[model samples]
Target: MLTCAVPTTLGPVIGAEQGHVRAFKGVPFAMARRFAKATPPLAWTEPRRCTDYGPYAPQPGQLDQPEDSCLSLNIWTPVGADGPLPVLFFIHGGAFVTGGGADYDGTFLAAHGPAVIVTINYRLGPLGFLQLHRHGLSEADNLAISDALAALDWVHANIANFGGDPDQVTLSGQSAGASMVIALATLPQARGKFTRALALSAPGRNIMSADHADHIARRVLAELEIEQDPSAIASVPLPNLFAAVERVGRRIADETEAGTVFGPVLDGSVIPREPRDVFADGTLRDVELWLGSCRDEMVMFLKSTPPAAMIRTSERNLRVAFGDAGWERLLACYRGSVRPDENPYEALLSDAFWHRPMADLARSHAEAGGAVWLSRFDHRPALEPFLSQGPTHGADNACLWAHLPDFIDRPILKRKGGPMMPADIDVAARFQTSLLRFVTSGMPDVAEAWPRFEPHRESLAIFGQPFQVVPLNEGARSRLWAELSA
Candidate 1:
């Protein structure tokens, strides 16, 4: 095995060469105690071997053992870059409760972009996001986001050694990770760290209010039977803490129709306001952005939900999310747009939770003078588990990283040993090419083909067999949402 060594600020790291890329895995970027802010890793004089991945944050059903010292990151850089290459710093998404940097292998993308790719692990679930400031544990606020920032700081300082341009970093993520991308773009701490952003399926409205976060924390404490002594939370067994998280998460989801209980909180300090508000107020006008979502984002969740419960829960959640009259209007609009096979509730909830908010964010950013590009992933692999679901959640990921085995093995698009169809390969190529162009040049395509998203026109690029640009809010459902917001 060919080995390559790069000297970082802390020490020398020995990575391996695979194909046309050099991969440095399991590199410690930061360290932190349970619920504490992350700190830079201790410096070392000798070279550290980073051939394998690091541990993920503690969560139920994870194959690898979880650890508190999970603030490591992985790096992949092209073998023969002409000069410094742009960096793609990605955060993984599992609703803020699961996923780690190890899950994504950036080797293919690194070689493809001829750019440096960095992915980091952060605290998850109750350990990372269980806000306890009101309960006297002030350090527990936004630890996960803090971990991400520390990783970014490490990359900004050391990635130059790996042939990455610090000033050309593109902050990117999907799902819960996408939410963090939006958070970082608007955060004061993240300013000047990255020049561009790419968010996929970002839950724009997933942020929790301080009161709701405190309530969840209180519920977790009560479940742990340590309501009087909240600091005891730091010492709770991993299994016990995760159990409490599971219980409280389910209860909260049932009560509030919330997708996940743990995420960034409006702590007035760490994350002062909602990301959308920041975009509306033009704080991120200088940052270039490429935002996108799958056409059927919620089918991933809908497949698991019983049809009856899906309807009942969706109705209750819609009523709670939008007022009685608004709920009626939303349903009416969605019914007209939904296909015969699609569930109206699924369409309504998907728009209410994911797509519409993404459009609004694009509009807000564009209106504020930020250069923006919006897209929708409409290509689905012609195979079982996928053909039935259309372009569902993670579908875009599967296509974007079709060269990666992890994405192929994703349960969302399990190919069952079948080879990819010609269309699948074509779409993957097109999708990756567009993203690579954006990462390198800050624009996905030619101006005429992929115009900058405008608040007045709302152009959206559709990624499918035949890629096309269309009006973002042309449909009745989108119009209704615009009307309702107005």
Candidate 2:
């Protein structure tokens, strides 16, 4: 592998080059003590080797025994470019708990689009999202979001040396990361940081109210037996802290039927207001937006659920989300619309959690005069793991990255192992090309065929074998939500 060095704001860093793409891994953007706000890493006069990934945030069941100094980012840039290229800043999604930037290899996308690609690692689980301001630890709340802001600030100040254009950055993320993208786009601090945003499979209701966050924090403190001395939480052992987080998280999921217990909180300081309201109120009117979700988003969560338990939980959650009168009507609509092999409850939850919210956000952005594009990933790879179910959560990653080996080799998307079919390559090429166009330009189409998602038309591009554009479906489920909200 060829070696090179780029001078960043801190100092010079060594990276590895392979063919047309150069990769810089594990470059620390910021550092922080346990549960404290992150600060810039100490400057190094020597050429630091950034050829390998850095440590990830401490969380339950992580392999690397995560460290507090996990605020690092990886960069992939093309070898030969005439001028500065657009930047695609991505955040990985493991429900805001178990993922790091190392999981995503942006070399392919960087080489294909010839655009700079960046992925970051941030604090996670209780260490990242736990609310501690009420307990006198004001700086500890929303540490993960602060970590992200620091990373972005680093890129804006330093990406030009890596052949990336600082003015044309596209902020993008998936799942929990997608929610962070939404939060960052609406944040006053994140203004002028990026020109465009792309969010995939962002949960509709992931942001916790202040009361809900305080309640969860109290539960965590009590679990650790530190309710009396909340400051002692900083000294708790890693194992004990993670154990408390898991127990409290599971109990909350059981009670709320929500998949995650940790997420961005409306702390009135970091995230001042609801993100949905920000979208509707035209706060992001100047930023371009692209949003997407898989067809069967909830199947990944419900696949392991027992039939009786799944039914009971889904019904109860639906009742709570849509109230009694709207729940029955929504259930009937899903039963009539879902496929024979599909579960109605899963479909309803998928819409409630991912699809509906994405569509609504896109519509609101468009209505607010922001340019928007909407899409749904419908191409199900001809793999054994996905044979029974349609395109489930995280299925789009395999195609988007154009690397099927990662998906087949690992248990991601429930794949034990499988051969890469011809369709996989074809779909991956199409997906990557469209995304490349979007990254380079504001538009997401190779040709002028794909239409913008206007409020009246609400055109949605379906990413299937023969990529096509169609109107967004506002069926009985959407109507029910609209009526209930009204």
Candidate 3:
């Protein structure tokens, strides 16, 4: 029973270090009301017991209890750390609609310490990113983004007593969480909150203007049959609100150019401008960045989508993205040739939606004289059939944090061949080492294999069995996409 009372500005917190790592779960970082900016947690006298995970914000298919004041965080620290450790503060990904800090178990990542890992939960879905200011609800919009900023503020103020160095915080996330890291990095308020960031498979195109946010909010109100009395939405039952959010999200996703719904809105406040503009203007000049996408970023989505539907969906998406003639030109570029089993539609979709955008962000950061390291995660798990494919979107996450709770569909370290493969151990070790290295230090120490991302010399680290740093010009699909875009 390793128990200690750590003093914070808020109060004393009691946490325990167990077998694998010491964890302090359900630590309230902030208190927030619906549609309002988050505030710091009220001071407490007694040492708050942080044994169980906190409630996740209300969203669809969440097994845990729903709560509005869901601005809590979970901290995992090394069992025996003498000095203040570097901090890895992670935000989760679920397209900004679903997922919580507790969704990721930081035990594995924390075990590689002398470093502390913190995961956070914020509001999701319409309750999160929808800007309701136009509906006469005058409150801070971008609630989810605000929640993230508040979480960082809390960490900066209180992480030192938890054996974490407030000055060496590394903000990290996957997908929407990655997007949040980018958004937060842009804000001046976040300037000194963290020293560095690592974004995994960031959804670069999800941000929308305030008008688009209002459009989604109106759609959700209509779906709930309360567009005429929008204020009633605040009092609607949680399940009803969830259903309305889903219906509106699906509708907007089908009809909108951005192709997604409910994300950080450019309200000229929280997110003053698009992330691209911020990056271009050197907003994140001080923060060291390690950002990358998986090799088959869109494969996970395509796995469930039928083959025929994949083709049709790709065409539809292209038509929506580019006009008729442009779509045809782009499609023709992809039709050149591919592997026997490779679907050109899937390849093009990956490029247009994820890969190109990720690379573009890297380019923009590099162009603005920011210190950035780019990577492509190509590590495939040792599956039974052994498909000659790259790692799917967010697959590196499972490998990176292998000590997470057992997910039914995603069994950790177990390929169909059964048992943890030696390759799995090697890959996990490399990933863990690289991640810890980057967190503790500013640059990734990938056995001296990776190079800093420079505009003229664009080399990307490839995380596979035989890890190597390859020039970005070596990838054929990326070349084709660049030519087509030009």
Candidate 4:
């Protein structure tokens, strides 16, 4: 590892180890503007401070309402950048609503291994996604993707100065953030920018359609009372425009009963194609991949939704997502005998969506001769109310980052051994240990040989304490997928 400087572009940026962790705040990767719509990025001059993570674009009405704007990046180079280290860049997820680089602190992540950890912020909701208003740059990138690309470019061009390997960069995201990882891989622009990717609890494409994105965009516009259409609304003041967006968001949460369906548009140029299509081809062949999902993913989201509602909704979504075939296959997989009263919905949610697709992704990649790794988040929820939503989304939030939740000491995940301590040490440790190995050597630390997934062997590494291979349920999930894809 070569220790290099953090570039002159960010003049005298902060964050030198200082005993615990070296944190730099307000690092600007791209100059931001609240342009009309579809606005393109303009570069900034003057030495910008790379010393900290910057302010969150704006998010008040989303889940967990984001406690603060520590919207900053805390670099944990345990040993300082004296030696070049593999970098792990994290993208926090809040269902594309609320969350910023502020959610995570790199200190704990740095202790797990010899890696440089960087967390970043991107525009969310109306600011980041809303498809209808592009303020007018025809060929500029999708706003959210552009933000990610800008950050990647920043890391590539400048990480060397921070004693980090720009070439060995691994981008990891959760939920919608995970979708970003997958999207980034398929993006023509992200080619070779990152060496590896880790996507957890995410879906690759819109299960919905253009009409859906359009409908939502239009609805928000209308609610903003911005009398004009999407194009016309462009002239509205940024604050007014955003106010309308928030109104629609509140309506989505409080008014309408519509299920959330935010995702990247199948925009022909920037996205090119859905990540599934891209992966099917050879777009991400050169990149090492790791995919994971919790044992009860639906439960994670369910923690917010009522338990009964969780089961009811999962059942309904299964029908909607997989349709008739999915419903039938699910019946067969768990058998019609599942405890009617027990609400086996969470387990099925995990298996059908996250677990199943992730496995399928591994098989498809390996069949195409790509290197891929797989795992499951088996940690259970400690609280009874949370137990039903076993290891919910962002469950790994605590373990991946440290000193992050000051007063929110314990995460939802429960340990089998006792209270406060997670019942699943194995799951977190395996994830931590293997990630360190993967970042350093470009290969994961695993039991036996880390074999590429194949149709027959279906070699996927389960990420409990002692990582090992787990068989994939192709037959059942295959039938369900056929329905889902249909």
TM-scores, in order shown?
A: 0.93, 0.93, 0.91, 0.80
Report how far off residue 156 is in candidate 3 (Å): 0.4
lDDT of 2 by residue, 327-414 (tens): 8787788888777777887888787767878988898888998889998898887664465667888777757764543343332222
Model 3 lDDT per residue over 1-486, tens place: 647887878887777776757889889988877676788878899988887888888777652455556889999888777759999999988777777777677777787666899999998887788788888764878888988988999899988878899999999998889988888888878888799989998865647788878788888888889888988887887788888777775566557666567677888988888887888778777778998788777666776544323334455766765678777766666677666656676777777777777778888888998988888877776542223444777767766766432211231112322344676667767877888989988888743578888899887888888878888765555665565567
The 10 consecutive residues of candidate 2 with the worst lDDT sum are 406-415
Report the candidate with higher lDDT, 3 versus 4: 3
TM-score of 4: 0.80
| Stretches > 4 Å off in candidate 2 | 63-66, 138-140, 256-260, 305-317, 382-388, 404-419, 446-448, 474-486
Model 4: CA > 4 A from native: 1-5, 18-21, 35-53, 62-74, 80-82, 133-141, 204-211, 227-261, 305-329, 332-342, 381-388, 402-426, 447-450, 465-467, 474-486
Residues 84-144, candidate 4, lDDT per residue (tens digit)? 7889988877777666775666666675566788877776765567665343422343567
Better candidate number, 1 or 4, judged by lDDT? 1
Clashing pairs in 2: none
Worst 10 residues of 1 by lDDT: 405-414
Model 4 poorest ten-residue lDDT run = 407-416
> When superposed on Cα atoms, how far off is each prediction in RMSD?
2.7, 2.7, 3.4, 5.4
CA lDDT of 45 in candidate 4? 48
